[model samples]
Target chain A: MGIALILVSTLAAGVPLRLDLVLPDHARRGKAVPITLRLSNPGPEPATVYLQGRPTAFDIVITRADGTPVWRRLDRAVISSILQVRVLPPGQAIEFTERWSQQDDRGQAVPVGEYRVTGVLPTDPPSELRTQTVRLRILP
Target chain B: MRTPTPVQALAAGTLILAAACSDGNEPTAPSNETPSAAMQGANQGAPDDPIALARGVPGFGGFYLDAAGKPVVYLKSAAHRARAEQALTPFLRSQGLAPSQLRVLPGRYDWTQLEDWFSRASAGVLAIPGAVFVDANEASNRVTIGVQQGSFARIRGIVERLGIPPEAIEFQETMPVRLLATLRGRVRPVVGGLQINFPGFLCTLGFNAVRNGQRSFITNSHCTNHQGGVESTPYYQPSQNIAPARVATEVSDPVYSQSKTGCPPGYRCRFSDASRAAYTSATTSTLGRIAKTAGPNNGSITISGNFNVTAEGSASVGQVVGKVGRTTGWTAGKVTNTCVNVAVSGTNLGQLCQTLVSARSGAGDSGAPVFKGSSNVTLVGILWGGIVNPNGSSTTFVYSPMANIERELGALTTF
Candidate 1:
């Protein structure tokens, strides 16, 4: 009976959250590339997700084909000091689009090559939810 | 192993050679070749060069260096790309370079298309509630329209019916726009963040300005006049006594002048929510720096007499900007939109194009100076109002660019 009750409690806790990274297959060297981070809750019960950063709630990292880190979205200084939390509803998906100027952390143009772009969502309790690696090719 | 013969060693060395040898008598590559055929054709009889060729091309949008540090030309469309390539290929060959040296990329829209959209939108063809702004995004090669959530579908349909391609139009969600002003009373000195006291209202001064040789300070037009009218009310700075001390008289508040006609061709009507107050003292009286805090606040940092007025410049989307005001002392924000048309509620002011910054600005923060950089501040605009969300959180702060303000008021920021 205890095991069955635990199963029921777990079912009532709602489904696990999922995050997807959306990026273009190819982009120009100096052009701005739009990257979308989509968060979806597929369970019946709604879950509250908190965004804990100023200006933007998530972070992005772009690395070369050999896994050498190139650029990071969080490296840019935040102008607004206010931090915000956004709530996510059940069965609904929310996406935020951020643009990358194809430059590295030092504000120089990134070399033309295949790169791996990763999106990470920082949650409470010092946990991080990472998305699947998305491949991007920088064309000259 | 057996020793290799001299001939065999020579053959191996020939295969492993790192550099090739050429006879000194061989003809050398031309260092100064005549201009390409495409360049000559594009420039006609004038100076034939890449820049001149780019300018003379019919559908050329612009040129920028690519990742390989080669010049690339942006053409209006695929058809234009084809024509441009055909004209330049022969010239590239004459210069001992391949057609690929001069890259041609397809542009979503040319300069003409963007200007046409701007002119039509400013002329009220696409004017509607919820659609608060229209601006050209050069980086994305599209025209972005900011609209309220309720009016998104309607605005999208209207834009589509007007022949704007679906891919070339972007819509952003925004709150209903309103003017930043309230009924209050106070005044003080400390140019940018000081209070301006009118008859029954108070506002923050934007910046100390100079028109011709006269010294003055600028503030929101709505501060001097609630309704669409002008008033020559005496201005005062906040004082320890009950009544503030008179510092200047309102010389011009032109926000509500109906006698003026439409702006001349190629220029949109200057819908400025700014006014200039002639200083009662000498030009050296007011400091040129913005206050670190409001005058009413005890920790206000006054501008030094030696401070210089930085040059005024335009704000780009994604650029960081800072502001000092009465309510929200010193705060920094990012420019979200450069050209935004806002409709102020409860006022006869129909719509005005403003520069939108993401910051926390309240009712009393209107007319504050929005500047860029910390040590060397460059004046960008004047705080007019902001969109306060239902929960009282501000989505964005709206201000008029200094370029428009200077043209409208015939004044510039004084050092």
Candidate 2:
């Protein structure tokens, strides 16, 4: 089995799956924060989904209160040759976590402010897998 | 809580065995020994501990903590898994962590291997049309090749001939590359990314630098010596119509000058296309900041305020960097290639290692200051020139990495 399979299981097709973003309410500046995505299958049948692009399909975007994007994980250059396909059974939730270095997309220290982090699980039909916006406050 | 399966138990046992065998030449630790609290506390504060340690170990591509909080180190080949596991398990144990905390995963290429592949590709395979930049993507253990439309087939043929597996190479369609040059366009107090008039043309000011107590501003050497001849020149702010404010003492080594001819055999050779201008005291002002704008990528955006630059540093592949140049103002882009050796026509610069940014820059933007993307920016590089698409939409801006610039000029960024 490939490393992706060992890390995250694939989901079956045609089964309704919901994505949930999980993060801390408050984080300190210059600290490492982990953002996780929970993909749950609420349907009775198993669902299969392809995690296209790079090793993982999750993207984290940080934007200011006015919706101006400050940073985005997917915006950086990535190796797009490797693709992953995962299958998830009913009532099964697979989580993928990525750590943020408390810096903006440009590798600079982010100012202390209220920001919104959106976790996106890009799928074929687009908008099929998206988590609720998580509010995070950066403390000095 | 989930119980450990038989396979998991066997894996844990293997980790313990690997840890014990890591230092076979050294005396084995007594099983009854207990770790000190101070040692455990210190280990707890090891920032990104596994990844930091793995970077020093050869064949280790990358690492991340699994869902179970186990450090999984990705190795280039399964053949080296035992060696990696043995090397890392002992370190984990020394850090007061269990041997099972370390897991070895297999990857197609390691960091050094990917770098070597890119170095070769940049010199040969990447010469094909549509191939804009070649860089290593260590996070995914693959070499990313940027190509324009209609070049994928040609690039694939080269990749096959190079014997690189399809899975190890990634191709992305990008705008055609072009060098940013124009006969146009700042500051000790005057600021960076602004216009600096020199002799016949203008270029962007990079940053305030100092060497042996002498103050100066760095800019593209080509701006000081446009005809490929090394000569000192006077620089003016705003425009040459203004009073001459500084004199450039050191134009970069003439184009195609190799460091190998001067340095010993074991020393690595470097090439630079940067020059420095000494302040004339007529203008006793300097600020360690780059001009920033409010809107992102809007050419019409105005300079909002200066982005504070605390120090200078090197940039990594895939890192997002921002630049403020006279023509483009404030623009941000991802670094596509680092350590690239390319030739710039007319400038007579050849085989200089440059950092490639995926942003459009114009002719006058040469010598502009490149900074990290953040509210508090740090000096990253100095823009020299880049390839602008035929239609003039996008550009592959090339720059001299700040580390290389500092070494070549023996100057340190003051701000």
Candidate 3:
């Protein structure tokens, strides 16, 4: 099993405003899964953006191979009302990352198995901004 | 038809950059297009409702007034001018109206037939592969269809299949319309100075306010439908059809009161162009913080920080103040006029005791919050309309003073 966790960052081209997710090919079990989120401006022009409150706006969900929900980032956590706005220059990016332990919302860790992970940057006035689900393996 | 109202007051909706007006007549224009003198005329069209005139005249197709304020009616043929005038005499304001005053023009089709073709074309226009949009152009008295140039022949065949008369439709070359790119425009805990979308218009929020335990935000009265007596008009943040976008419902938009004291005999008058929309959720919006952008609008705009409100006060002529709006971003200017009587042209309504600022603003900026600070400032007023030249852009922006806003909306806590 591997020991390090890494996720590559990328910026989409052509599209004016985009939020992309980055994850390393695959990671070993028992190690913390480092996930990265970036709100990028791929278009040539600068953009004025209003973001949903931070930390709260970023979410992740882990599921079984067959698509059953396992753990969600925002389940019972109370979210405070927060509104944020910032200007993004062309070709630039902003990042929000979270390290997820191999465990679910509950403190218990799962047995060695294959799972799928998805990231979401639910900006306000929500858009079709979700990361493609990636397969993962938690080695015993 | 230019009203003799002050130059600064007629273009008052310049409260916005895209210049959205909060007066009952605003956002009547598309919320995103730049507020231009021509656009205002197009939105308000002729004050006389020609469609209403088309109601009875046999084969009548259109109606309009000449520059001299005389009525010019359109009929299926010049032969019907005498009969048409006889038919219209009962309903029209015929006094002082010379027989030559009721001029009649030739039209190709009957208004009824055009209406039927419009309905059929509307349901079938988009079915044509290259068709972009459809409209019942009353002035031309025909169903106007916008389609790609190369696809005209294909659309013509498709139009025949849809059973719409070929002679009744005018095909024009045009490209498809697209939605604005707005990934960063949506806000949670909805803040002031951002765009707000309604059925067919976009406007800016003024400021978060609280009156007697109720939480809400202020925009222009025109931002709503102006059908008073209910909190019915719903607004969405950034745009419609998105989750968690419903931000507020109009709660207060009082009808304009008329008086010889401050208003013309036919025009309506009000203390402020302000109105309130209660937040849909208790925690859906934030109070006193307005979005700030680094510079003027240059196509791609971005928010920098916010001008946090600290107190509430008034400004005198020559005193500088600033406002942030969806179209123009953040811009400021000196107080040009402390108070003046402003007339909203299209609506035949006037605002009394309003303030004017010589600031750079545009369409969709209506309902922007006007204040007197850079980062920390005192709440002063809410932007509504503007004053512009007959064929020029607006140079002065107008607003409802905080004192007048409170007087019209009742006491509210804005900071």
Candidate 3 stretches with Cα past 4 Å from truth are A1-140, B1-184, B227-231, B242-244, B295-300
Ranking by lDDT: 3, 2, 1
TM-score of chain A of 3: 0.78
Q: Can you write out model 1's per-residue Cα lDDT over B1-415, one digit (the tens) per residue? A: 0111112112223221211221121212222234456654665412234433444555654444445665455565434544444445545555555545555555545645655765555444346876666665433344556666667667766776676656555555655454332112232344566655555444577888777777788887666643234567676653213445567767776554433344333332346767788887622345466655322223233432222347788789999887776555666778998766554532334325578888766545568888887656788878876664422245477888887777678767456
Clash pairs (backbone) in predicted model 1: B36-B91, B37-B91, B187-B237, B187-B238, B188-B237, B188-B238
lDDT of 1 at B89: 52
What candidate 3 keeps of the native contacts, as a fraction, is 0.00
* iRMSD (1 decimal) for each model: 14.6, 19.0, 19.3
The TM-score obtained by model 2 is 0.39
Docking class of 3: incorrect
| Fnat of each prediction, in sequence | 0.00, 0.00, 0.00
Question: Candidate 1's C-alpha lDDT?
Answer: 0.58
Candidate 2 residues A1-140, lDDT tens each?
00111112233445567777777878888888777777787778877665433234457778888888788765532211112335677789878888888887667888998988877665431223555566788889
TM-score of each: 0.37, 0.39, 0.42
CA RMSD of each candidate after superposition: 30.9, 28.3, 26.9
